[model samples]
Target chain A: MYELTKVIKDYHRGREVVHALAGVDLDITDGEWLAIQGPTGHGKSTLLQMLGGLDRPTSGSVVLEGKDLAGLRESEITAIRANAIGFIFQTFNLIPTLSAQENVEAALVPLGVSTADRRAMAASALEGVGLGDRLRHLPSQLSGGQQQRVAIARALVKEPMVLLADEPTGNLDEETRDDLMALLEDLWRELRLTMVIVTHDSAVARRAQRIAVMRAGKLAIKQDTRPAPAA
Target chain B: MFATYLRRELRRRSRQVVLIALGLALGVGLVITVTAASTGVKNAQAAVLHSLYGVGTDITVTQAPAAGTGGPGGFGFGLNRGTRTRPAPGTKFTSDRLNPGQLAPLADSAVTKIARLNGVAAATGSLTLTDVSISGTIPSFGGSAGASGGSASGGTPGSGGRGFITPNVFGVAGVNLTQGAIGPLSSGKITAGRTFTSADASANVAVVDANYAAQHKLKVGSTVAIGGSTGKSTSFTVIGLVSTASGSGSDVYIPLLRAQQLSGLTGKVNTIYVAAASATEIGGVSKQISTVLPKATVTTASSLAGQVTGSLASAASLANSLGRWLAIAVLVAAFALAVLLTISAVSRRVREFGTLKALGWRSRRVVGQVMGESLLVGLIGGIVGIGLGLVGASLVNAFTQPLTAAVGPTTGSATPGGSRVFGGAGQFGGSPGAGPGSAFRRLASSQTVTVHLTADVTATVIIAAVLLAILGGLIAGGFGSWRAARLRPAAALAKIA
Candidate 1:
């Protein structure tokens, strides 16, 4: 579970200091599907990065399972990400030189995993994403949807406690987007991975267990789906 | 892992490695060949000189002309002890006179050994003859002597242009020869009948140089008669002939006492040969001889060895010159290789380096990686160069004639010394280094004579080559570090191709 409490993220360029995230606060229980909806520059991605411990908040607290993410050193934060945080970027940042399976294996190589175990786990993760036959295909050979699926498989390979995705369907066609949405819904039900999706899509927002709306670098509202549906 | 990496690098860069090897091989091979050829000259010189002149005959007490009597060319020996000093040119009685009895005092000192210096197979001192007209006829015919001192005009072929026997101002070796007791000639090089026996000293015999024998058309057992101022001297039979064609002319060699007796230069044979205990003892022998014969300077075998290897001296004189050129060439190659590797590394890594730094990879790690790459290249290059040089040295050695002019016809003997020209697989051997007969003799003490690509020379060259490679590696690594340290982490990582 991650609790973000009034975190401000600032960026300074030359003489200007812009507040990307200003006093945002939110909390979500474990195993829940959460969606953050915001326009560009509204601190949606910054909030996700803070929650994932990949970026530090300029002020205030990003607490994950009672650990203060902002207080950790860079290496400690890296270790936390590698162990418990999984990121699904909008662009599917897979290493181009490696095949889907090899890309998954590269991350594990640095972790000192045995080759046999790495391949078996990677294969299983690919199968979970219905990409068992495309394990050997390189990112260049994959379509946008398939490459995103490979990224999903990579994110799932380590079995992290949470998956954080930024604009997951932002680059896909309408048909592939619907299929991916269904797959994610099914995975969410079957594996029960606590995941947060940051997107502008009202449709994707509608599918989540909870919705958090951000505006002007602050979270303006959060609605619980079960109670809000009755309203 | 390193070996595997090396094998991969070599395989991947096979063409480049081969090119490097060939270049290095050619350079190494030439060094070996030239060094060997110079060594040959030394060996040939040593062998010939030793056989012609005994190794330890100290102080060749030739009569020095009174100061400032030099003609053009300085007569090449600083003075002409050969020409008459007291009388007219070619006078019958103005040959040098010295007390051979001066040798007696030497026998009492550390100079326990002594031998009268002479250049012939045998000598006879025959009952102390006052004078010997011992002449060979011009034959009233048209045959030339060995042509040693002959003029281009042919001298009218024994005509008044000139008609005379090859002259002889003799010495005392005839006693050794007539008695058949000739010493080792480069260890058992006998090309004629037996040397004379001790009884032959009483047998009234003579032995001569092969050059003289051939010149006069004389053969073994031939009787040679001569007239002397004392009386008609004994007619002696030719018993043996020395087997060197080195210098020309007919000079009859007689036994030691006989030659002294014949020249009336008896009690005046100022020179004697004494073998040093060993090559290491040459200096000591020289010192011992100096002490014994205080009036004369004792020349060591080293000095004479130098005299032998004239060609080797010339070659070695080129050492600094050739070494400097080789150093320049090697340095240029190393610099070019360093620049190539460093430039390539920098060019290829511009974007990657930026990415790594942005990803939180530290500056020190980036520097370390770059240096590692450079070190890898240098190590590979050095090993390749050495292998090529070794092969090249072998090829060169095969074609080389290993002798030196300085190493021939030495006049002094070190112990365990066998004198011959530096023609026999010549090597720099023993202590005191058998000096050259000329200026290099002074350098002998400081000069370490390297072998001619024998086991010894091979070792020296290898050490030098490896050291050069280490130097190259340091350059590569240091330059890489310098280059890497100057890069801006943000800009370096930001470049995208």
Candidate 2:
């Protein structure tokens, strides 16, 4: 679960202060697929960063699983990121020097995972994404779709409770984008992860159980596509 | 994980690592070679200077003859109290010589007083004589009895017109105990037979120099006639032969009492060799010797070691000075190059490190990664440097001659507290053999002695070089670590998308 209260993020571009997320208030439920959709410079990525604990809000609180990230130490926040949440970027940010399997294993490095367990887990995660045969292939050698699959494998290897993705299909062809989206949808369905994706694609927003439309650094609307269960 | 990361990074950047390591190795090699050579010179100087005074002798006290009274005699040698002073300059004694007086103020009593001084562990006297004549014809000088004084043109063969034995035959008195009983001519300096003994004092026994005996065809146990400046000649048996080729080639040696009686200069000595209670007391003993005899010039081992030898001294000095500067320049350049390379490599990897940080690597961990990589480079560089240094040192040793010039002989009155006042005199008279227009007075001799210098790489130098290599790496690594620690993961990871 995640909650943001009156969050304001200001950026300094030379002399002027630009408000990226001004007085934003939102909530995310556990195991829900939520999509934040907006045009460029509308704080879609900023909100995702706050939810993932990758960046702090300039003011106010970002709470995940009832823990206020603002009150946590930097190291504690990192442990939360490493153990409880995973991030996937639009460009599929894999270290160019490492192979697909190694990129997946990297997420577990900070957890002090044993090499044998990390290797076995990494191999299983890649196979789950249908990349078992391409484990040793570097990101440069992989197709856009395959690279995104590797990114998906890396994000899921830690078995985090939440997955934050910023423009997951923004850089791929339409066909590859559809395939990556299907893979992400399958992973979310299979793992029951609380998936938060920031994207402008209408097709991507259509798959989310809830869609929050952002405008002018604020969440202008929230559309519920799926009915809530007992809770 | 850190080790894995470091190994991967190093493997990916092997080229850059090798380049920086080579530069550092070159710098370290030059430092080693230059330092080694300097040490070699110091070692050679120590050996030669110790041998200058005689075995175990630390100081020499010589009464400097007043300038202008004596010409810097043949062989580029400084004149000692070789001959008795005449009443007037250039006034040849119609008789063979005049009675000795005034000049040699050092006496047996002075030796006793010096021995009593603090820090004076042992003191001994040696008498140097010149211009005495030998009756036998030395065949090398055309086999003429008076040939020693002939022309004053030629000295020993191959002497290059210098270091000629003076016209008057030269004789030495008293065992030069300044070097202790081991004798100045230790080892094989005494080539044949045995040295003189106390029993030989009244006996007409002499130990001739190797060169002098060779020229005159004199052998051990052969009797030869020797005449002093006093116009009195005696027949002495040649008991031994020693080499004076590397030193002032004084021709003969006799007992102190015998040489004193022969020269008519009694109760006086020309040179005194003093041994300090400890090496630390040499300076004190030197000061005391000056106090006892103000006119005396004291030369210590250290002071004499400071005197540079020939053109090679300049060469060694140039190597010492220029080598140091060159090494420093190379080290600075290498450091700059290594730093630049490390910075470039680190800057290029900002996004990768940021990603790691975002994945929960602490700033210290990032810094450790950078430092670890650089330290690996440094270790390799140090190993390479050691190899290069050894090769460089060996090459220098191959091309350069390890030799130091032996410090030439010093002459003065030495009286180890005893009754023997070692004294001798030379001819102050002119003879037909004295040659035309040449001063009949005996001349001092000079010869060049060479001592070997062996360049050695000391353990201390090796350790220092290794440490320097590591420091160089750490310095370069520090710069990289600083840059790495300053990287913000949010800003850096944002750069990727």
Candidate 3:
């Protein structure tokens, strides 16, 4: 599902250049779950953003299904993000004015789904996340765990091929975080979704099929947790 | 989705919406009130002008009196002085004369020439004359049976005389019998009987003003004796009673031919009233008439509007200058405030907008949402503003007083001496105690008309005001949308709030 080689990302912070992603590359197969672990400001989120086509690399190529996301036009990149990729933020950035069902429906809006179909799909997605009863509740009215469930429902409503999560359970308690991780693992295995999760918790990283440790803007090591498929 | 999002967002910021709407409402309301007032003042001026300048008359042509020819030429009593045959003291003498005072007469052919000029639709001539009657008893001189007299041209009182003099004065206008659409009587409405007809061109007929008729206790078909320039009285049948607005116009109206014959200035007229075929051709026609009659003073309506004075003129100036500028200033401030507040609201919604963008919403869609919200606010403001504007206009019409407009010479020096035909008594050989009547006082060349000002809010003005409000909304929305459109989703989502 993805092939990246020698990707580099830079940022300008008041006349000083910060190499957020320096000469890093990795490849992942279809339906694979990969977790990137790093300290704060160590380019883990930056690399995740590049893989999701949310940010452009300064140099090198990030290939997704034989197309370089780094070299694609702005409109083409936007379409790819709309149709193929879903994002989950630590803050669960739900529109304050929209309800849980509406927030999930917003993901389907870009796909031009009819209103009735969009409502049905959003409700089903929320139910799958165990949020069927919170469909009409605003984000402010829901607890942190419920809000994250809503965010997860919003991300998976459009059935994107790839799901990129940046510290999805960072703002939740330990119990809620463990439950959210279990739910994410179940969804990944059931739907065969290519999931890339960035987290600082070693326990969250241990659940992935493979783990890559990013240090000082470079990928330092990669470890495979599951045995080779009995070949 | 658009409507839901917009409604929710507006509800969240209801206070800001109301504030912007009130600002816009104040601006629009003031604009409507000022515009209505300006229209009212303009209408009042037109009414005054119509009364003095005559209806449908686009231009007037008159000649200034020659340097020495404007005065009341000698009365010519021709009394013999220091003669034994002279009349004894205590004898009574009476004299009455009708003549064009302080006005130079143009040849009757001048009117014909002007009528034939290019761009001239119609032309008619009029003679404005004053009839003065003086009667007094001969004074008794001490130790003398007969009085010594030179030519009694000035009506000077004899030394040591005990007699008194009385003077009666009134205005008369000679109107064209065939052309009644372009003269003084054109503005008058016939209240009784009928106006002059073609057959009455040479007949001894007269039309009396309603106010003048009421004062003299006269009616239609009554006989009024008018003294001519020859000091001979001719009894004219009063055929009509005409009422003029604001009690303006001559006391009596007679056929032009009869007035010419009676005044003994045959084939001469003091005033020429001309009408143009179209309003747009008034200036050209005035120029043509001036060329045709070089010595005549050609005055157009626009030029006459500049000469108007009094409270009505002041109101017009205020409404046009200060009121207009103030409305514009307030409207501009409102627009600026709306724009600033809308931009601030958009800035506060950066995270929300970024989330939508990440959901694959295009930049245009985000900008459109912001514009829709701003435009809705503007529409609300426009509706409220219209209501407030109508109420303001009503208040203006209810409380405004009747405005008076004076049109003529603005200064005493600019006033032609001949225009003062109805001067104070004793200044023109009249009694010191006797003065002109109220009707004659209003007949002065300088005219003042009292008109009740009305603020008429027409449909066109309302439509334009609405369009202006919409435009204000568009402008504010445009700026806010531009700011929204420039936001990059990646950078916007990275914001803390």
Candidate 4:
């Protein structure tokens, strides 16, 4: 469902140019899970942003389902992001003022879902992430692992075609990290979602079907786990 | 979801919201107080002008008295007749005469001519007169009759055998019975009996002012003998008693034709009061009248307003200058404060906006959320400000002292012209106590009338004040929303905290 060819992204810090993504080429089939592992300041997050249509590549084309995302207008990219791609940040990034249910409902807001239907879907999604009893609790009241679960529920509530997570378990304890990974794997298989996760933890990266390691703005190596297909 | 998010956000920043609202309230309250005070000052000035320049009269036309025409028209006691000999000492004599002070008479036909002019709604002529009566015993000058030179002065008995001269003086106005709505008597309210009718045009009847009637113990139906320039006293019946609002009307009101005949200025009037068809036409009408009668001094209400002086005028200046500027400064400061605080609040919510954008909410949606929060705060401020304004207006009315206004030179004198007898023997020169100096001094001399200032807070003013507050809020909110709309999701989320 995704293709990348010579994706090169650059950033200017005052006068110096830093290359974020350099001549990268990759592809993934529909409903496949891919993980990118890299050191800090490498191209992992930059590549994820490009795939999610959050940012454009400086010199390359990113094709998702036969449409070139790099060439689309900003508004068109926003529409695609709303209808197809869901994002999960390392910090959970839930609106601090809103409750868990309201945060989950925010994902469907741009989809023009009615308030009543949005609330029902948000509740069901939160329940699917084992957070049905915490719908009314604010982000400040929830633990780190619970907040991550609410973020996951928010991402999947709109039933998007792709789920992109950037270090989702980076802030959680080891046990909570394992539990979050297990929940993500289960959702990926059950919904057949094409998932791409950017992470530094080797243990978390090992759960995906394939792992791509990036170094110094280049994809240096790729290792396939060859996991069984979903039943 | 929008409502929920906005409600929670405002609740989170409730303290800042209250602070901004209070700032707007203080500004709006000052605006209302200053505006009300200005209106009150204007009302007081109008009342004073109405008192001096008859009600409904927009312009007054008068001519400066020619060379030496305004003095006492001779007492006609045969002082100037060479055929009559001096009277014997202690011989009782009485004389009374009515003369027009300081203003030259305009022909009565001028009123008709002016009334026919374009934009002239109505015109009526009036004769403002001074009635003077002298009654005393002629003194013996060194056991001989006093030398006569058109001067007759007497007082308490002294080394020169002087005798007392008692003088009674009062103001009289001849009002046109045909057009009573545009002259001096128009401002009076009849308290007893009735004013003049068309039948009284040639009748020897008069309307006495209430204060003058009260002082002289003269009521309706009392006989008052008024002397004419013909050297004959005409007994006129008091037909009515009228009271003026500013206590500034003539002591007696007589028919126009009778006053003209009695004053011996037949077919003439000293002042012409004119009303224009519309207020907007006053300047044009004044110009027209000036063109019609070039020698006539035409005074409009606006020009007369400039001549008003005293505490009321001071109040008007204060309300217009210092009060207005202070209100504007406070309102501007309030709006600036609100804008700064709103921007600061939006800056703190950068992460939340970034996350909303990532969730596929349009930039306008996020901006709209910020605007909604600010507009609600502004609405609260407007309501609170209105309440504060009402309280402030009431306090002004409660604590303010009654203001005084003095209308100057254009409307004759506040002090009536009268005969003054010197304390010497054989002094007999007429005191021409009416001229530009006397007329200006008399009218310019402060006729202090205590006017109770009222802050007229109308519904329109309140509505405008509220709208002003709301506009302040919209401006502040617009700045905040602009900041919010410019946030890029990628850059915003990069700053984790």
Tens digits of per-residue lDDT for model 1, B1-497 = 12332344345556644543444433444444344434444454444445444433322211111222211110101123234322222332211211111021112122123322222222111121111122333233233222212322212222331544332222223233332222322123234555555665546576666765677776778865532323235576877676642441114545544554543434333333444334555565455445544555454455655554443465455543574466457556655666556655456556544433322334565566655655555555556656665555465467544433433333232211222111000001111112222111211222122234231245665566555555555565566666665665323522210
The better-scoring model by DockQ among 1 and 2 is 2
Instruction: Pick the winner on DockQ between candidates 2 and 4.
Output: 4
Model 3's DockQ score: 0.49
User: Which parts of model 3 are misplaced by more than 4 Å?
Assistant: A226-231, B71-89, B141-163, B223-225, B410-427, B430-445
Give the CAPRI rating of model 4: medium
DockQ score of each predicted structure, in the order shown? 0.13, 0.45, 0.49, 0.57
What value does the lDDT take at residue B290 in candidate 2?
Answer: 89
Between the candidate structures 1 and 3, which one is better when assessed by DockQ?
3
Q: Residue A221 lDDT in model 2?
A: 57
Best of the candidates, DockQ: 4
- Candidate 4, overall lDDT? 0.81
Model 4 chain A: lowest-lDDT 10 consecutive positions: A220-229
Better of 2 and 4 by lDDT: 4
**Where does model 2 exceed 4 Å of error?**
A213-216, A229-231, B53-58, B66-294, B401-447, B451-454
Q: In angstroms, how far off is B43's CA in candidate 4?
A: 1.6
Residue A77 C-alpha lDDT in model 3: 83
